[model samples]
Target: MNTTPVTSPVSNALAGWLATAETRANQKNEPAWALAKRSHAAAVASSLAFPTRDEELWRRTDFGGLPLDSLDPFAAVTPARNIDDLPVLLLTRLAGEGANTALVAQTDSEVVYEQTHPTLVKQGVIVCSMDRAIREHADKIQSLLGSLIATDYDRWTAVGEALRQGGAFVWVPKGVHAEIPVRLMQFLSGAGRLAAPRTVIAVGDGGSVTVVDELLSENAEGASMYLGGTELFIGQGAKLTFASLQDWSRNVYHYGNGRAQLAKDAELQWIQVMVGGRMSKTNIWFNLDGEGANAFVHGFMFGDSRQHFHLHTLQRHLKPNCTSDLLIKGCLKDKARSVYQGLIQVAEGAQKTNAYQANRNLLLSDQARADSIPGLEILANDVRCTHGATLGHVDSEHLFYLMARGLPRVEAERLVVEAFFEPVLERIPLESLREQLREEIERKIG
Candidate 1:
């Protein structure tokens, strides 16, 4: 790993802000364990080299034009606002009637609002801010915070962990089953500000939970930056459904790292929808560590204007009889561009493992671009692995067929594009959320 300090203007600005974050953490009376981790991450971030265009992972995506020094890493938190101001669907999902869900909302650095249903509280489910978790659920938080997505994954991960101010922590006890989902909303409100949130979710043996995370901005005016991390742990025989929706303003730049670890007989279903952000880069990983483990990852992306997206995924099978599947689809228009890179690895002892990966892209305009790279590494001869990628334009015959049936040309094209994404959209568990995504897609298609 490269440890030389980066000399870019962005790196230097981040270094100065990280130093200030350490000072603030010390003065806040933070727990010793949490403080130590933050300090170590900050040091690592300062020494690590920033990603350049030469690196294979970043060669296609450019970050050279970003004015990193103009963004504030230690911006002050704005005052809290009423939940009524948010969208009706989001409000219903977060704190709806008869729903045993937990909700946490953060703006800038502070957790402006947090609530947990009383019934879930009685069942030993913990849903609160990271700050509160560090003070109240110290043992559980310390054991799982950086266990999955370690701080050293890259400079961005280290920056997110070191400077993170607030996020959600959820724990479901053994044998407990949460019928309703736990929801977290992180909103960026001001321009030239930085938002870094770290989320950790752990389900005990035989337990189950559904989690939904949303990242949004008020509008598409001022420029902002978002650096975030997420870790999920599923114990033996446990099941988890995780979904993330990112709709930041067109002026914001976002980067995130997410990971999940599964034990024997554990199952994980992950869904990600990306429809916003000026330039976004996200990396997701899954580890199957025990027999009979299963995982499924699905993602959707839509980009317009000059927006850029770089998405990467990894699936690692370390035990026997494990299964994994991944499918990511995107549509690009105008001058937008997208890149998808995926890898599936089966260890030597991971016999009877089955894995599949695919990425499909649709170019809606002549100037739009999309790149897909899918790979597999199998050390076990008995295992089965496959990978494929496709990049194509809208089928002209299909469009013409729809137009001949009394639909306008634009409407026909939109319908065909919607059909292209329906396979992934139909898999979303929530009807309301699915409809919301459909509406967003429709708006973009127009």
Candidate 2:
């Protein structure tokens, strides 16, 4: 019960919450070093200015409006659902295909499933719950988790670490290439409560794997909240394809973070399709660590009504001879607002790296708002980097021509959206998945 005094009640309460999480971490037998890392991050995050109406970055999104700290809907663990309809079957085929990859899955509350493909098992791949990874693979787990994107030691993130409940852990063996994608799904049920979905995947040198994370709701439009995070580490010469689909309940407030580290000659491809959260903020970071590394990021969002979706991307080039490219597009209507922020960075010694970033948006109505801010930071003299952002409305001429051809406004817009999204969705490697994803985005637009 060691609590220090703070200036604001909100800050004080936040401190108390962190203390509680630390106590739980100790109770769970987390090593002193792990707890120390959490404590240090908490301090730094707490000191940062809280977004208010005054801050330009958050003004458009309006965090001061939500009662984020008072939302006490979080639970420790959730039980598995016995269901008839399985999620995207073929995605599961990767796991059933024989373990060239290890898989770990935790629902809102508990570790519902885990598997190490038979092929991967024989290769010494270890995929299990993050808790187990922390406990058994203590040394490895300690080095990666929480070391990526610094979690803003807020009520939401503390709730994430304190009641983590369950999450996946993937470790690929050096030189092994997974033939399929490992799928992880989190479905919010009636026992519906706040869920923090966390996942960490590490690829050994020359190894490869694909991971799919799905977030959906049980009550078809139920109200829920999810604070989720993901991190990927690609060993030198490895490859990884990570897809994140945010389809939580329409009433859920979601904040998500995805990150990756690319070693020499490694490749990372990331895809994000945000369709169902009531309000969401997405932040993704890619760090290039070795020469000849590459990263590609693509994102699209369709939001309507009061939905507010924001995305921030950072492509950091830390080594020479790296290449990274990003393309993000969003469409909004019915008073919804969307935003995109992209920044590309080249370190002092990151010479010979080529980087590019671009963001585009389509506004279908006067009330719908879209923001695009693309920036670049170059520290190396010989590196090449560029960024671009565009925000515009559907061309009236295009709309008129479509309508003249007997297409309805909705259908016409659908066509335009499809065209705009194709550049991003086409990059999805799996055909079946690509089709289903296009269908989902179409439905959301409708």
What tens-digit string does per-residue lDDT give for candidate 2 at 100-134?
33445554555665666666566676777777787
lDDT of 2: 0.74
Per-residue lDDT value at 44 in model 2: 57
Local distance difference test values of all predictions, in order: 0.86, 0.74
Candidate 1: residue 209 lDDT (0-100):
92
Pick the TM-score winner. 1
Indicate the TM-score of model 2: 0.85
Worst-scoring 10-residue span by lDDT in model 2? 82-91
Instruction: Estimate TM-scores for all models.
Output: 0.94, 0.85
Q: Pick the candidate with the highest lDDT.
A: 1
Residues 407-440, candidate 1, lDDT per residue (tens digit)? 9988898899899878888877667777878888
